[model samples]
Target: MGTWEAVRRGRLLIALLVAAAAIPPASSAAATTLPKKAKASSPPELLSELPVHAGRLVPSSVVFPIYGDVYPHGLYYVVMNIGDPSKPYFLDVDTGSDLTWLQCDAPCVSCSKGPHPWYRPKKSKLVPSGDPLCAALHSGIAQGENSGQCDYEIQYEDRGSSLGVLLYDAFSLRLTNSTRASPILAVGCGYDQQSAVQDASAPTDGVLGLGTGKVSVLSQLSNQGVTKNVVGHCLSGKGGGYLFFGDDLVPSSRMTWAPMSRIGFRNYYSPGPAKLYWGTQSLGAKQIEVVLDTGSTFTYFESHPYQAFLSAVKSDLSKTPLIEEFDDSALPVCWKGQKPFKSVSDVKKYFKTLALDFVKGKRALLELSPENYLIITKHGNACLGILNGSEAGLRNLNVIGDISLQDHMVVYDNEKQHIGWVRAACNRLPNADDHGLEDGDLSQYASMGVLK
Candidate 1:
């Protein structure tokens, strides 16, 4: 996962939460568990039942309204309901991470003041240390020390860390078909949190991990047959947007897809090697691998590409009326016009579009307009949103963050092993009526009240 970068000061906070371990309960219609390896005759089957409200059938898709922005907030978040008697917690939406967690009230040793009160877990909710999920979290390490309860610790790149235990709790979700379902999921009940930031009030309660991993919430949902192993988000430049899980919300056509790269880290969504271009001219930078990470606030490039891009932009601006704003500390690079710029729209005309042409797909090109790479600071100057990854300890890694993803519908199709994107008006949710189920699609879900 990419580190969370503070847009104001460019500080990085990388995340790595450890702990582990799900099966849906039988009492709830929405709950169903994957068969244990010892009990199953073949591969675990899909849920034999889906919850139905009254007599009407519902879709498997789950949607959440996204809040916050790229500037002051430096991240986007969503409110989620958890536990038996559901309570809401504000979670930062992160596609780069896999383990979803919440700050716990288990006699917190070191914790930040989050938006909500700490989560109080019942004894029954604790995941047993012997569980397979718990073993997965303790992978690559010895685990017998925590014999009774599953213990976990996540350390970030910025030296921040979270210590906690694993627990199974109900995730209250309202499907796109306008019906509610509560699926049991594994979550980290963090009791200790050490952050690099000194701010007392935490920006979010915790992170909602949407990465492609077995322990991810998406995989848990897929295991229970609540939804397909797919997720998509639309972050509007204006402020708020929406996120959805399942293929039901995916468009039938018109979106461009690039095959997912397995070159580097298996957890991230990488689209293989891409050549950088300033308009139609090549920047002479080598083809670099890029990862689409929502956890990062700004786009990042290798040192060579960063320097090349910086020089090109500066040389282009020399011919224009825009002058370098050396005093502005909002970003590494800033440009001031004759008058203060209120938004990207006010100064975008002065800048050229950037493009990334991927080598793996059929002319797969990600176009970054001036709006996609420029931010209007509080001082009313346009600042560059692209940063140097090498300085941030990213080394050769290139990342596409929130600034470059604004107003685009980016989909992580884990089931198909591909990533797709298309320009969109992200301020509102897609019409539910446009995504009706196809033939035989209804059979994938079991009848109400039936269980495997």
Candidate 2:
């Protein structure tokens, strides 16, 4: 996803502002600096475990505040515009981020490049900084000047890129039940991030925060005297989910529930509420705490548990090809036959001659585009599959991200204490292991708030 700005419009606005003497002082004016704190970056380890319980839906509707938007990729997104409640502009939406910011022009050292639209008040009535409406709009970002320059910037851990200007606008959102709520949205003026290699259709724009608080969009609505929790259901089929801002749309009694865990508000990257279980066992005593992040497309296990899983599943994995690598930049690996065997040849040439089984029964010829190589941790061999089914199973780890949850519909039902999943995309047919939805173990979802 990408946000674009018109350079000509920016120049014209600058010229008009200069002539009118409306531009703020270039110097002397203080720039807004948000609070800063550093967290330990060491790989997260097991912490004290809490009991694993599911949530139950209470009677009546509960309304919560929400900022309507979409994340097509790690890039472009869309936010409801407040001034023009009917329109949503594509902006960069980040989760490992707290300060929900947009591109704003402020003559800062770090500004977005290229041309795009700038937010000018002369043409719109969207609330400005310090205004009662703007102040009350659930902005967690550090107080900063929204200089009309329409430029902005926000960075991530992987050094994933997002730099642009801020464009003040209005946004409109509706709950699953059609309850309406609109807030002023900050659309990014421009963007600078690499495109995804897999699904190139992702749009990048404003971030939709999943933070917890009476001040977050969800909390604001909940506190605003509504009758629902933010009920989120990611619809993979349509490529987006329905976010109910202020209504209890979930069937709590029929659904499973889990207890909520308090996470650091500033550590936006933490998965926050989910628990990791040992192959469907009791929590805490035999489980681990984990963050379920969609941004990270791969599953990374802690060294200890990871090795244990490999030891247990090694026999199953061994039956497949023992490929030393999977270079996505060049040729991708594709295995054939019931049992895939490791091939020793030019990766590019071999990949073209084969097809990888992404899921059971599903096979696609590998292509060379965006580069990514799958490698073995020890011998540093380029391994084909990354199913690190550790000894801990599902009970000992901290997370089960997209890599592990593929072909499943993850339903975030805060109303009922647990999360839910519905197997949508299934890979069936003959395989060394049945990685299909109907096939494979259903034990993973047996304990959670899973629904038929």
Candidate 3:
């Protein structure tokens, strides 16, 4: 599906902070005296893999931290360095969308107050035409309105678009051993933008597409022989998570693999008959077209099945001592006032964990903890992060957004067409395969501690 049809509308809140934990500053001597040519000309290095399994060779790697916000449940972003004398940029990471691009200095009437100044291609010092990886990129690029410079255009679902050009620059990846390296590739630089593309609140520097399309950044790298076409991410409920490129499996995490059916129309992955589970009870539905999307902030199910699920939840909540009601207009399924919660943490006390059961030899995944589905609002109310999704024109389809997929390592393997997951604490550098969890026995995985 195109980004316009795939993504939900709304601007992610402008993130002003950086996510990397301990990046050593490039020496001032190198920053000042080093020729821009040397910095731009150095052969990009493939990243070293974080060893997890027995003797699995990982040649190239790229690691970036994704950050999330609490209130509006904004989208996640990662820090990527580009250009000569490399400057860091915060890009919203998405697996559903196509084409990776950044806001640049072509010409602008209005633009979001980005985390950093726009990337100037003139000073970037890399020729886009000569890069072997950019050969395909040069074709799609069109000229700007008045300026004849090479330009690219991206249109989104919510009437958003970013216009720019293909620029060749060094894409820096921080290695696991505390060293930095870069791989020169074709990266987009947007000069003009409109609507959600330039959201001031979540003024993202750009977007990094991890999509399965040929035009995507991951596809470009794979074609250039830099890395494999595999992606894994573990978005935490609180915000941020672990993300890695290639099959750099960590020892602490265990994953269950399900083959992705190429028979589907969309470019994304999904499991067949993905039924919803409340503890041991299976709340079956017609069909759950699960789009493992990181673009949206909340989980969305179609109305027919979603409404039934909501009723079951309300009936379950009725068993608890009813709380005094207040204005609870912020969310689709919400409860407010002092009736149930002393704070947001008390939500898990009443709610049961939900599992997604996929058909196959694969396991039923328990990805959504209470904190992942229950969002705390500014009005001291607990709002459900799950929505009807009618506005997005999703009619019998369910979107497995970032919220519901939190604290679980989701691997999208294009080579094997395998989609897998395992429950994880996420913040730690865990390398465990699906070691502890039982895929065959449903009764084995009881819900963990309450949200409180």
Candidate 4:
């Protein structure tokens, strides 16, 4: 599966912002100072065994504070401390991809400018080529029996790529139960990185893949008994949110859930077929499968659904003073008012709320208000955040991106094979008492057999 599809879209957004003059010019000092390089280390010997394990007393849940925003950054990121000394690196959080990777200082052939220094792996941390995790990275390719460094290469649909070797490193984490744990996990040490659009301002050091594949960080943590094989995130529209591993933050009630679709690729979180609706009216589009991807900056719909959605919105705006703004290059579709729109609330009166009524799991309904699908550009015009997936080479795939996920607690319950969501005030983290779980109590979790 392509891991950087959403990242490529984010780059597209960056290019658009540059074109619209939304991004300010950098100072001479900031532009001239390049990221420092690190020396390359020799490949290490094969690991005899996986060294990480979580005891029965380990916490069931861990939460990380998320930084960055969808508007200026086009992504949300989390800082993770890795390696023996625990160096922090900013990772763009992506739920669509599987393998977690960091740009390495192994004398990188080509690398993007990031906020932190390159990750230098130790000589003893290299993963062997004969490992099963290495085989997963080489899926569909024939592998030899020779034992050496586990080399990997990933190419994105947007022509971005990474060449790297796999390694195991310590991830220092503090659980919500006030316990600290260090888990050794597999990670890609990318020695070379290339992108279709080179944005020096993009601050991500690498990707934090949260997909359902066995190679995902979440799955590895689950296997090591660090936390349950579940993950959730709440991305605020205003900025900054929280990401948690396990079910401690999940509400006991008042959350709508839909079964995860098993029909498609395994890495994505697909919530089966859903019919499109404009308020209460059906848009006459066929039921479209939706994948919740945190990596993408904007929502994408299949061709038919996208066209129907565009027409419905245009028809509703016919009676209003809002006119199509073709000059705005920020987004494909945008509308300008009598005066420039200061926010989505300024022009929301002209548009109706859109909903996706799922055909499965109690017919769960996902409502998207104007603010959810409209972005107020730097030009002060409201632009449509929903794009045509086919045009972006997604073909029939429909994606629910960050724009539509604002202010919602989205949960991916891999252990239960379902996805859940509820409207939330994402500005703050939920208290332990709010979820009915007292501090330092794993008894309830043990009763459910989730805790060891």
Candidate 5:
């Protein structure tokens, strides 16, 4: 799928998780997996404390993979590595995404499987586990000695990935303070293979999903403290942001509140880049505590008010020669001069225009001229369905995936209560950074909202 199309179709199209290597209990929903509760309080004392995380943090920058683009233009930088911490790896500390991976050693056939871009170990300074410097990492998050190489395969809600061996690397995690510091245990590794159409690429190592589960890097960091919990407030826009690994990072103020529902780890994760919902009407009838996920590209909700949403905007479309769903995209163009020729790209544009009304005053309808918004599937053909999650049977639960979180600053405070969001206007630069994208793919377009 094209980049914007992926965004519009469902920002939550890709996600992965490494479970207990065992089947979840039968009670867990087929799509969701709640996390197992660990020690509620932080550790009593730092287990093998590393002074590197202490002292003055440094400025660090990590790359975010711009889905569907093929050049560096699609990639943007997030200040993640705080100073010169002992371990550093580029990570999109996202609740929307699941797997925590990094770029690793290349030259393996297993790494070339997917169409999306994969990380290349060759460009990174962090060596694979086989190297002597990375022995400690293997003992921690990289656990395993049989093979000193980093290897992992994670399956997200929508996508599955195979990552190469883990390598101890440096990553930047930015703080709202305009300061950067590298995490002490940053690891680097990339997906070995990706599906061709997925638009995967090797941006900067991999993503770090900070969901409410044991597998999260935040949870892993908890191995260091007691009484203090990990807290992260990822600001939505360009003023930049900070992610707190421990309690010391939290601010002193009255915080918004929401009772957290500890559910299955994978089942409850939401998609991100963060979408804010204001007003009581936007909150809907459900008072569910949710996580914002970046791994997914689309939104998922229980039949919520989808029908109401569609009913409100269905009349805005015009009839065209496009066909919505076709097992084969190569269709016979019977109408040679039809004004609205149906195509996949047209379908994507249609969804993009439709999503504007869902958010509060947030209009992503960029240069979508009349000609630019094409049609797919005939006006009444049932084959071309607008929403994709319904077909995949992901509608049972409430999830605000990528599509819904667009253009807003989301604050996911697991330490506190409730997920908070605020309106943000970002300048969508044309030079979309595509650092991690695959070759010859113009479908991906990464936009770093230069917060206005």
Candidate 6:
């Protein structure tokens, strides 16, 4: 499934501790053989002393698998090297899903086994017996050596799951030429996983969440001082983008700043808001709130605003014939006839720019034209990436998912308690002497009222 569709369809595997209400009891939800936990917190949250930093960028290689064009663009995969021999593992890069887990050699009831050999922690020096840190990760009742290891279970809304032991291990960011090392970070050694889609040969090892969740790989790195608690990703609409850690990834001077805020946790781990104004004709003249989520695959809104957005968008396309019955897209809304246009390039001119407007009238405009959110499928049909959030089970908030984030440098700055973005052609942005937008201008966004 496409990343956006995955979020809507609920094809997710969020950690049990991160979203306990969404999952089952840790013991009953996972393998029956190993020790179980009545409840569990992510390893990073359990950590009292954060690890030290080496100061480097961890580059994980990503591959965009082709889901149907009807679906939003596909999800990316991360390849990491683990263990003493540094075996390679293919996993998904999910920003909202935390816990870096891998399919283990232990055992499984109904999981599709990957081609790579399962990682056996016995040989690795990363986790030793009687370590308090590992004990802190313990779940259910602690058994003995082979069993007392920290247990973790992640159950998805769709009923798929990965339950297993947790491990702190050496990980390498797989890069060309040379590999960068990392201090031991928390990783879920998932031995058993239930796959919604079969063909064991095809399943990704596990997910690597690069989100704000405390246990997330991004947070783990930051807590350890490898980099500041900052993360950024630039996904290209055409394909191929980069994910980075640390200030050196992009110079602060080159970025345009905007205040990014989150409502006090829960109501779904967290709901983020971005104030903006969108319109073409008489519609979209008022300010709107969209939830910033990498977990969601597309943009969405309530029925009222959806109609406004649709009408506003339709008013501008005088030349393009929009086919309403686009069966190719998994999204609720899609159109065709804009193609003879492979990709969205040909139809981009007719689309509009979406602006991020603040209280002081300071605006950060993002071009959400076809080049950004429209997917021209292999079937030659053009699919609009934005959908109705209400139909997708989002009630109180509109979503600004990955599709809308394409081609932009989005920065998640937890240290300064701010977030910002700027449009850039390259995934690897150039360093700037003066980083960030003017502080006073950013205050406009910082001061806007939050939705939640």
TM-score of every model versus the real structure:
0.85, 0.48, 0.73, 0.84, 0.50, 0.71
lDDT of each: 0.73, 0.30, 0.57, 0.71, 0.35, 0.51
Candidate 4 residue spans exceeding 4 A from truth: 1-59, 140-142, 199-201, 434-452
Candidate 4 C-alpha lDDT tens digits along 341-419: 7888898888898998888889598989887999887788888889998898777878898889988899999999999
Question: Per-residue lDDT for 19-47 in model 3, tens only?
Answer: 11211112343223221232222224444
lDDT at position 168, candidate 5: 37
Best by TM-score: 1
Q: Could you tell me which 10 consecutive residues in candidate 5 have the lowest summed lDDT?
A: 34-43
- Give lDDT: candidate 5, residue 393: 59
* lDDT, candidate 5, at 261: 46
lDDT by residue (tens digit), candidate 5, 321-348: 3333334231211122234444434334
Error of 6 at 430 (Å): 3.3
Q: For residues 94-206, what per-residue lDDT tens digits would candidate 1 score against the true structure?
A: 77767788987765666788889988865556666666666666653445533455667766544566767677887877665545567788888877777767555677788
| True-vs-predicted CA distance for residue 378, candidate 1, Å | 0.8
Specify the poorest-scoring 10-residue window by lDDT in model 6. Answer: 443-452
Winner of 4 and 6 under TM-score: 4
Residue range with the least summed lDDT across 10 consecutive positions in model 3: 443-452
Q: List, residue by residue over 1-452, the lDDT tens digit for candidate 6.
A: 22333433324333334322122224443444333322333332222122333743443211112111124435545456665456767666555555677776554444565647666654232232234434333322233443334555666433467766666665644221122444557777776676655443533566766656665666766765555676666665655455556554455465665555554442122223334434434334555555455554566676677777777676666456765654653545556774455757666666776554543213544446556567665566666676766664555556666677777767767666556677765333334223332322212222111110
Q: Indicate the worst ten consecutive residues by lDDT in candidate 1.
A: 29-38
Where model 6 places Cα greater than 4 Å from the true spot, the runs are 1-33, 36-73, 113-115, 121-149, 155-160, 173-180, 195-203, 266-272, 279-289, 318-320, 358-362, 427-452
Supply the global lDDT for candidate 2.
0.30
In model 1, the clashing pairs are 16-154, 17-154, 48-446
Question: In what order do the candidates fall by TM-score, top score first?
Answer: 1, 4, 3, 6, 5, 2
